[model samples]
Every structure is written in structure tokens, then in C-alpha cells.
Target: METNATTNENLNMYEKAENYTKTSLELIKLKTVSATADVLSTLTSRIAVGAVVAFFTLFLNIGLSLWIGKELGEYYYGFFALAVFYLLVAVILHKTQHKLIKTPIGNMIVSSILKESKN
Candidate 1:
């Protein structure tokens, strides 16, 4: 009778541990899914907005280039001037990209993952 009672207690403990392990795994999965969804949604919205802004900037630049060319007496000259201006800007950005671009993006990803869910 004593052995039987001890065996039963051990079996109950085993069941409880199994339940705890499964529940913990499920919680981790839920957290991972929630974080991933949050990051993807934010990125999707930003990309959409970025695309719209890019189109606007492109058209504006084209118009400005034509105006500049008209003033310079040649269309290609305006484009060449704009190209040189952009080349300078690109060089500046390349020099500071780690500070201005990479760090901010990395921080944003980390913050997004660490952010607590309202639920």
C-alpha cells in the first residue's frame, strides 16, 4: 500500500511538470508571433509612406531639372548639375550612414521587439 501511494504521487508530479513545460512553450510562441507581427506591420506602413514620398520627390526633381536646364540653355546641363549635387550629398551620407541610418534602424528593431503588448 505504501509503495502504491508513493508511485501515484510521483506520477502526479510528472504530469504537472509536463503541463508546465507545454504551457511555457506556448507562451514563448505567442510572444514571438506578437513581436513579429508588430515589426512587420510597422515596416509595411513605413514602406508605403516612403514610396509615396519618393514619387513626389522624383516628379519635383524632374520639374526643377527642366527649369534649371531652360535657364542654362540646355536640358542635359540641368541634369548634369543635379547629378553633381546628388553625388556630393551621397558622399556625405556615405560618411555618416552608420551614425544616421544604421544605428537608428537597429535601435528601432530592438525597441519594437522589447515593447510590451497592451494585452
Candidate 2:
């Protein structure tokens, strides 16, 4: 009777351990899913906004070039002027690329991941 009782207790403990392990795995899986979902949603929204902004800028540039051409009385000269302006801007951006782009983007990604972890 004593041996039987001891065996039963051990079996009960084994079952509890197994249950705890399974629960822990499920919790991890849930957190992983939540974090993945958060990142994907953020990316989707950013892409949508970027698309809208790009189109807006393109149309705005076209309008400005047309107006400049009208003022100067030659369409291609206006485009040439705009192109020069863009080249200057591109050069400036290239010079400051790391400071203007990389650090901020890295910070944003880290913040997003940390924020998701908190949730």
C-alpha cells in the first residue's frame, strides 16, 4: 500500500509538470503571434501612407513645372530647372544620408519592437 501511494504521487507530479510545460509553450506561441501581427500591421499602414505621399508629390511637381514653363514660355526649360533643383536636393540628402535616414529608422524599428513586447 505504501509503495502504491508513492507511485501515484509521482505520477500526479509528472502530469502537473507536463501541463505546465504545455501551458508555457502556448503562451510563447501567443506572444509570438501578437508581435508578428503588430509588426505586419505597422508595415501595411506605412506602405499605404508612403504610396499616397509619393503620388501627391509627383502631381505637385508636375503642376509646378507646368506653371514655371508658362511663366518662362518654354516647357522643357521649366522641366530642366526642376531637374536641377532635384539634383541639388539629392546631393544634399546624399551628404547627410546616415544622419537623416538610418538612425531615425533604426530607432523607430526598435521602438516598435519594444512597444509590442510590452503589450
Candidate 3:
């Protein structure tokens, strides 16, 4: 009878240990997944904002091209000027955006905010 009792206690202890291990692993997995999701969300938001800015810039360029064409009396010449201006804007914006993304603190802050919001 005593031996049986001892065996039962040992089995319970093993079961508890197994359960604890599983829970710890699950928690780690959840944290990892959350962190990855936060990173992706932040990056996606940044890209989306960049796209919106680019779109507005393009629209502005088109409007300016039409305005210039009307004022200068030649649509093609005004369009060429607008094209050069648009190229300049694109280059500057691209360089600025690239530098911003490369900054470590930018991602850290963005990811942290996203993670906090998710919680």
C-alpha cells in the first residue's frame, strides 16, 4: 500500500512538471509571434504612408502640369518641366524615406507602440 502511494505521488509530480514545461513553451511562442506581428505591422504602416505621400505628390504634379500648360501656352513644354520637378521630388523623398527606415530607433518606437496597442 505504501509503495503504491509513493508511485502515485511520483506520477503526479511528473505530470505537473510536464504541464509546466508545456505552458512555458506556449508562452514563449506567443511572445515571439506577437513581436513578429508587431514588426510586420509597423513596416506595413510605414510603407502605406509612403505610398499615400507618393500618390498625393503625383496628383500635385499633374495639377501643376495642367496649370503650367495653360499659362505657358504649350502643354508639352509644361509637362516636361513638371516631369523634371516630379523626378526631383521623387528622388528627395526616396532618399529621405530610405534613411528614415534605416534608423533603428524608428522601428523600435513604432514596434513598441504597435505591440502595446495589440495588447
Candidate lDDT (C-alpha), each = 0.93, 0.89, 0.82
Candidate 3 global Cα RMSD: 4.3
Number of the top TM-score candidate: 1
Which residue pairs in candidate 1 have backbone atoms (N, alpha carbon, C) closer than 3 angstroms, thus clashing? none
After the best TM-score superposition of candidate 2, give how far the Cα of residue 14 lies from its true spot, in angstroms: 2.3
* Tens-place lDDT digits, model 1, residues 30-104: 989999999999999999999999999899889989999999999988889899999999999999999999999
Per residue, candidate 2 scores C-alpha lDDT tens digits across 1-119 of 99999999999999999999999999888877877787788889999999999999999999999889889999877788899999999999999989998888778777877776687
User: Residue 88's C-alpha lDDT in candidate 1?
Assistant: 100
In candidate 1, stretches whose alpha carbon ends up further than 4 angstroms from where it belongs are 117-119
After TM-score superposition, what is the CA distance of residue 93 in candidate 3 from its true location, in Å? 4.7
Identify the superior model by lDDT, candidate 2 or candidate 3: 2
Question: What tens digits encode model 3's per-residue C-alpha lDDT throughout 1-119?
Answer: 99999999999999999999999999878877777777778779988999999999889877888889888998777799977877998888788875765576676866685665566
Model 1 scores a TM of: 0.93
Which stretches of candidate 2 lie above 4 Å from their native place?
none
lDDT measured at residue 33 in model 1 versus the true structure, 0 to 100: 97
Q: In candidate 1, how many Å is residue 77 off? A: 1.4
Candidate 1 Cα deviation (angstroms), residue 52 = 0.4
